[model samples]
Target: MPPNSQPSPPVSPDGTTDEDAVLAVRAGKGDTAAFGALYDRYVEAVYRYVYYRVHSDTDAEDLVSDVFMRALRAIPRYEPRQAFLAWLYRIARNAVIDRARRTRIQISFEDALAHPGVDQIVEPDAGLLALADKETVRAAIARLTPLQQEVIVLRFVEGYSTSEIANLVGKREGTVRGIQFRALEMLRTLIPSREALA
Candidate 1:
């Protein structure tokens, strides 16, 4: 089945049952509704991850589609050994790498938001808002190495724990934490004005 294009998971006034792994297992068995549920759950996150790497709404959207397409095909092979989010993110990271290699794409993070759509994907930070432009924040992040970029985005933006990030990135937790620190240090240097964050 194609990736779920459903708007959102259903919720009654009381609550809704939407455990990701359960949905994934069901989807693995060719349950279209279950797969759609999974799609609704992860689409925004996948888009956010892709947006940071590609820095272009069009590219990010395309890559997100690709990620889901690949996911749909591979769900049958997915095991519950890890969180579905972790597995999905691994796929996304790989997709970005593959696309970059195929196209020889050179990402310019600062200029990525020149398109209107990406602005919605990356909520402007209070500090970044102070920069008086999203591009400034993008430029600051652009200066980070790819690993630094992933660490920073996952750490601060997505709020993933170091261990969780380490699992996703295939690094040790210490390494992920160190990368986060260095990425922050680089951002501090690149965006010297504290008010830029204010």
Candidate 2:
């Protein structure tokens, strides 16, 4: 790739985030229709994040709903931190972590493997539409620590930029880059052929 060339962005499946951002702004002012529009735009991605972290459909569903509710309340103060989705993602991540801690349980690799279908995930290098079976990728991600898994998911599946992820996770940009590099190295060891996902 040329130095001047930009990395390709994940194709938006539903083709609608700009509209959602506008709606989010309106929703902050108490527009139920606007909020509903925003909800419809991102519920799937939010659910995917929650479900991947918690590995339970029930928990993910609850967390996604709660995250949005909190977001709604917080939206009045939502300053549009990272891109709106990144901001929403940050909220979802925290809720997932808090939910896991509250249960006095950590999601283990075994648990994640037990039900891989919870998140619609793809291979590390594949087109977003050509997702690997959720279980296979979930099991591989489970092999890493939650922090590593989170970075990997954010970098790959969620397609956050290094700077964006750092802001989302409250880490330095350099730290986020280092972690992403390390996560890839670890993933290579856990699952051979780094380019296979593509």
Candidate 3:
């Protein structure tokens, strides 16, 4: 209970200690070691999340570092109301937005789609593959609304489940599904078939 002492770990209903909550509490009280443990545990997941959004390895790595720094500074104020990862993701999401605003850098849709993960999204349609080259796909993706683009990238590129995306975006699971459905429908319309191109 001392000001500098670590708090007891939070116990779940099943009586298991929540490791993340424990680390978060200790970090909140100035325990750099606990904060480092948290950083080691989540850095990769945060990197992937940022990388897909920015579509740049260099930018993503920089943003991931920024996210952790921000999280560390804010740890004293952090409440374990949600998963620590979710809180970190909110910081990352904001960092990406802030970088975009500061640099006015338009994310390259071609680069995003060039990632191997995107093949999984477009592979179901042979016509799409045959007709839509990187430029065509890029154009189609760029035409999507920002929210639609985010949903598409998170779902297809990051492979997050609807519920997980809902948590990250602070939307309902049903809403995430609706957004994904609408985004996919828009993509179908935007990307012409091979027959249409012919």
Which parts of model 2 have CA positions greater than 4 angstroms off? Answer: 1-21, 107-133, 161-164, 167-173, 188-198
Q: How much lDDT does candidate 2 score?
A: 0.64
List where candidate 3 sits over 4 angstroms from the true fold: 1-17, 106-150, 186-198
TM-score of candidate 2 against the unseen true structure:
0.64
Better of 1 and 2 by lDDT: 1
Question: What lDDT score is found at residue 168 in candidate 2?
Answer: 57
Model 3 lDDT, full chain set:
0.68
TM-score of each: 0.71, 0.64, 0.66
Model 1, 1-198: lDDT tens digits are: 113332222221123233677888999998999999888877987887777676568988999999999999999998875567778888987898798789885656665545333423222333532443556556556557778877777766677666667766767767776787777655555553544334
TM-score of candidate 3 to 2 decimals: 0.66
Best by lDDT: 1
> What lDDT would each prediction earn against the true structure?
0.68, 0.64, 0.68
Best-first order by TM-score: 1, 3, 2
Order the candidate numbers by lDDT, best to worst: 1, 3, 2
